[model samples]
Target: MGWGGGRVLRDRNVVFYLSGVVVSGFGSSAMSLAAGVWTKSLTGSDSLAALTTFCVWAPILLGPVIGTLADRARRRPLLIWTNLGMAMVLLPLLAVHSSDQIWILFAVLTVYGISSVLLDAAEAALVATVVPETLRGDFNGLRMTANEGMKLVAPLLGALLFVQFGGTAVALLDAVTFVLAAMAFTLIRVSEPAPRPAKAQKWSAQVAEGIRCLRHQPALWRLVLAGAATMGVAGLNGASVYAVVDAGLHRPPAFAGVLYAVQGIGSVVIGLFSGALLRRMPERGFAAAGIMLFALGVALRVVPSAPVVLIASAMIGAGLPCVLIAAMTAVQRETPGDLLGRVAATANTLLFAPNAVALVAGAGLLALVGHDVLLLVAGAAAATAAIGCLLGSGTRAPAAAPALGGSVRVEDGGAEGSETAHDSR
Candidate 1:
């Protein structure tokens, strides 16, 4: 299956959007790594160090509320300002020094996480508005590639910077990248229609609309339910990495990095091919396949062979992104532009909140169960979720599209005649 990379690249809007994503992803990845190292250096506590990640992800629980902000303005401007605002927000990190001041870093990262969620919603809305249906898959696949590509170098660079110049250097590096990303966003030439005035409703009511949209659609619900289960299991798998190295494979803790490296490679390969695969498969089918593949990989980890563990890591990585891509692509196609921001945010919350919670739950479970047992349970849970999707493939479609002010209309399976509102530059 040939990925339509050429068509995606030929579009300048996609190119600029990908460039911004790559630039920002590098900074974010680097900063994430360095933040942990920085906290450990100052506080000498692994719990506090891990808290950095929690700070970044915990705000996802508020996604439905925060997402409404995206629907209030044009998406391009929202993306630019969010990037620029976060850049300003990150600058405060440069001032942090003593362990007592570590709270500042957490504060900044929390805001960073909010912006990340906001940008995610806005970017999905913008992509749905501007990118062609035929090329959307390729563009999203490349987007995943660019983000994953950053992990290869950013973490090492951040670690080096932390060792050499301290955490402030990494903060500055990330701030610069945010500013650069803002610049890249400015270069995307597309016409955005003004946001429709959402009838005056209570803030909670507006948020509920996003939740309602996701639940009302049969396809979206099944895919999201499966995605939530898979990601939660993934968080469990993440918690098992060290234990697996020590007990399952009888390797040094450092061997964990080798597994991650192999996993990253698998992620990149699948991201490149996701566009082609989605073209031939329904989102639920694609997502279910991914879930099963991921479950098999986790189950195989119990084999205890070094080669087998590494191969399992690759399979896990390849399988993980499949559901994510399918879910977001489905959102882009199935959602009306008016509610895109809030709906995307709601879906993201449903998918990721479980993962965040599972991180804590997995850590606790590890204390009580063997890594092998934990993985087996995780694999079984994920597999069961996939089977539910497979058996429920004939679930009813969503109710007809809403008559909204924006140009987008809900279409079945991204039909060839999918009407998009775009002004070619």
Candidate 2:
């Protein structure tokens, strides 16, 4: 592979894929913000506002199946076709003219959700193939940074575009980005490692293979549990919009968006330094500390003050990515090349499955008891994650090397190899 554009170093595959991801990410972000605003404008119901999160996350529940397809087939086609399909799905959103058509918007969002599942599975599989095993952590961090960075701007731009040109224009813009992403994928060339089928394995056997892969790894499973629990608690924060607005705070709706931006800033800062952080802190330490911060934030929300709530929200958001990076690093480091997609998808499903439930439950609880009760629920869940991390012995430094030896390598100027080897036992 040669460098592109006389740049001292470049991997064409990474460049092409990164370009596609950045474009697609921006579009997705825009559509996401527009959809939320549209939903709120239509129903003026907090539960419906939370439904946007539900639709976004529901596809993750099918992550295992989507991941299996990615692992089983060629990933390039998956990426290209999914982006194109997503573009088509968004096309109808451009026709929305009235609040009564909110159901149409929901239907379109459901399609987007499905596309997201495929896109995420394909992207994870594709990155695993193109980036060598040694650099997976930094690469993952960089990927998050790019996605979140785009998120930071997408909402502001979407708000402006929606105001100036209407939601139809914003939807059209999202479709164009998808088309561009598909074109970018067309320029990338990398073959995924062939999936090794167990001889005479039945469908059940295949499912077992993926499950067993996760089950035998106690530490990885624990991390998965931790992620699911933490995400569930975070879901409450998302569903608390009504409470925030009812608190009599000036510009409460605006505060939600600003707090989200603050969280993005925190994530970008942590992600940029993730390589160094991962090297110094064990996965257990990172997981525990992150969840603790999140728990503290949720706990503080019980106070019901605007400043305190915003501060807590920011802390919770910042802590989440840190825990996620640590969990993802462990999975990427240990999983085999052929199974990486399935493992990643499986992990993703685990993380999001509870989140979906939490969103619905949080909405219902907010309606039934109140936002304060929801905060208590969120606080309890975060505390559970923190405790789980503390108690799970597998999260600690390995008593001895468990025989898995592989690494992910990214071509970017970021750290080139896995950080695990540098840790002093």
- Give per-model CA RMSD: 5.6, 6.4
Candidate 1 C-alpha lDDT tens digits along 127-210: 888666545666677777777778877788889888999999999888888888889878776667888887879989988998
Point to the candidate with the largest TM-score: 1
Model 2: lowest-lDDT 10 consecutive positions: 416-425
Task: Report the lDDT tens digits of candidate 2 across residue range 208-240.
Answer: 566678778988888888988898888777777
Worst 10 residues of 1 by lDDT: 416-425
What is the TM-score of each predicted model, taking all chains together?
A: 0.92, 0.81
Q: Using lDDT as the measure, which candidate wins?
A: 1
Query: Scored by Cα lDDT, where does model 2 land?
Result: 0.68
Off by over 4 Å in 1: 394-425
For candidate 1, what is the total of clashing residue pairs?
Answer: 0
